[model samples]
Target: MKDILEIRIHGRGGQGAKTASQFIVEAALDQGKYIKAFPEYGPERRGAPVAAFARISDKPIHTYAPITNPDIVLVIDNTLIGFVDVTKGLTNKGILIVNTCEESSKMKEKTKFKGNVYTVDATNISIKLLGKNLPNISMLGALVKIANNISLESLKNKIKEKFLKKIGEEKTEKTIESLIKGYDEVR
Candidate 1:
């Protein structure tokens, strides 16, 4: 991780993109890192494309603006590849993580991204582990793994802390399980 790492996450409105961003920042905060998290919405509807931003730094963050050039980009919805320029600001040295069954080579052809790309089947992981299509929690696992700034244990604990009261212990465990699978299975 660099002195500061900025991340951009792409997903549909109801896909939990905002939640993922908050989780990333919250976990980073738990590590005593300065952080920021926010969302950008196109339409106010459920299926509309949305973007979320998370900034993590070891020192005090001075910039409050949206990340124009992110260090890492995470696409929670593969359908937005063509519809949205998810790689618009990613550098050749940056990392791109996508939630899809497609290979990285295929993604490179589609997105024309020259950076290191990682593809993970977060949907299937969530379905198998959480019994739902909630890719947000599992995607957190991939985010932490690729970013390498936030600890996986910190993230899982954060999720548990946030969801334990709202979703209970059983569902929280499933969410953590999906996240772990995504962390281990991303390629």
Candidate 2:
């Protein structure tokens, strides 16, 4: 991990992009890192395109603006590849973690992205385990794997702490399972 790391998350509304960003922030904060997480959306509605930004650093982060050049980009919706410039402003050495059943090379080719690419079938995992299309939880696992800045145990603890009260233990467990599957399956 460097002094500062910026991450951009892309997903549609109702897909938990904001929640994913919050989890990252919480995990980083739990590790005593300075962090900021926020979401950018237009005409709040389900299925609308949404972007969430997260900044993590050992030192204070001065900027409050959306990340322009992210060290990592997580695409929770692979369909956004053509619809949006998901790779715009990504660093040349940045890592791209995408939720897709397809190969990373194919996704890179389709998006014309020249960077390290990782893919996971988060949607499938979520549907199987949680019976929903929410891939953010699973994507978090993939992000942890790719970013390597936050530990998996820290993230799981945060997820349990945040979601347990809202979704109950059984569902939270399923979500964590989906996340772990994503972590192991992302390549």
Candidate 3:
């Protein structure tokens, strides 16, 4: 991972973008990595666009400003591509991950981004495993694939620890399965 791997996640309200950011930070913390997460509410209403920022590093972090040039960007909802500048500050060497069924090539044309664009059907993965459309957790699986700072086991264990009681064993297991599917199926 880079010394500082900054990430921005875009999604609609209630889509779990904030939760995803928290997950990333918590998992990184478990590995003793310096991290930060910030959630910016869009319209103060559900269904409105929202974004969350996360920073992971090997050393102590000091920056408190918003991430303008993210090393990676995750779009939990593909529909926000046109409405939000998902690739606003992403560079040619940076990575862009989106929860869409579209191919990377097509996404490149749609977003006009030349960097590495990865697509995962997190919506379907979540619905199939969790019986819902919450793709935020699944997006973490995709992030795990690209982020070397945190191991997959660490993320899964963290999720299980955090969600087991609130969501029960069955649903928590399903969520983990959805996350694994997102990890394995990202392209």
Candidate 3 lDDT by residue in tens digits, 63-171 = 8988999999999999999878999999899999999988989999999999999999999999888778999888899989976568888899999999999989999
* Off by more than 4 A, model 3: none
lDDT of each: 0.89, 0.91, 0.90
lDDT of 1: 0.89
Task: List candidate 1 segments past 4 Å from native.
Answer: none
TM-scores, in order shown? 0.97, 0.96, 0.97
| Deviation in Å, model 2, residue 45 alpha carbon | 1.3
lDDT of 2 at 139: 94
The TM-score of candidate 3 is 0.97
The total of clashing pairs for model 3 equals 0
lDDT of 2: 0.91
Residue 62 error for model 1, in Å?
1.1
lDDT of 1 by residue, 79-137 (tens): 99897999988889988999999898999899999999999999999988887899987
Count of clashes, each model? 0, 0, 0
Q: What is the C-alpha lDDT profile of model 2 across 1-187, one tens digit per residue?
A: 4678999999998999999999999999999999999889678888888999999998999987768989999999998889889999976698899999999999889988888999999999999999989899999999998888899999999989988999999999998898899889999
Model 3 / residue 23 / CA error / Å: 0.3
Estimate the lDDT of model 3: 0.90
